[model samples]
Target: MCIRVGEIENMINQMRKSLISIAEETGLNSDDTICYSKKLDELITRYQRLKMNNKQKINQKLKIVTG
Candidate 1:
């Protein structure tokens, strides 16, 4: 039951969209939106790194299986 890289990317995109919508609904100013956007970007970066590490682990297991 492993998640694929594409799925992870999709999840990140969805999260960003949701955050943007939330910010808009809150009627926050541009500066506030920018701050939240920065936080979202940081979160996305961390998720990407985690996904990459998981992918590497899966690849290693695959290599071992095929070897």
Candidate 2:
């Protein structure tokens, strides 16, 4: 299924929350938490870069239309 930018943003928000929740949990050792934390960071970074690239594309389109 195709995912929209809004969905990506929503996922980013959920991951942000999950990252915080994982940080707060006491029982999990660093070994377990490290994997989860890295995955969240990767997802968030990937989505953010995607969002930025999308913005750049839209701006280019606008410039083409206006020029």
Candidate 3:
């Protein structure tokens, strides 16, 4: 479980870094680049929230089983 959480964190970080790099390459001052960055951030946040909710559900199930 710890390893999986760590992996997810790393994946999210990598995705954010990649998006930032792409934005930089495209020139952040441009409206398109800014829009892309904001979209990416929103998507990532949504994904992470979904992941956390799923993890919590699984943990709740595990607790029921173990307790």
Each candidate's TM vs. the true structure? Answer: 0.57, 0.67, 0.61
Q: What's the C-alpha lDDT at position 34 in model 2?
A: 73
Which candidate would rank higher by lDDT, 1 or 2? 1
lDDT of 1 by residue, 12-65 (tens): 787688778868876567666777778778767877888789889999999999
TM-score of 1: 0.57
**What is the C-alpha local distance difference test score of candidate 3?**
0.73
By descending TM-score, how would the candidates be arranged?
2, 3, 1
Count of residue pairs whose backbone atoms collide, per candidate = 0, 0, 0
RMSD (Å) per prediction: 4.4, 2.5, 4.9
Comparing candidate 1 with candidate 3, which one achieves the higher lDDT?
A: 1
- Residue 47 alpha-carbon offset, candidate 1, angstroms: 1.2
Q: Show where candidate 2 strays beyond 4 Å.
A: 16-29
Q: Over the stretch 10-43, how does candidate 2's per-residue lDDT look in tens digits?
A: 8778877776777678435665467677877887
Model 1 residue 54 lDDT?
87
Which is the leading candidate under TM-score?
Answer: 2
lDDT of 3 by residue, 1-67 (tens): 2335456567667767877787778776877667667766776676677688888999999999998
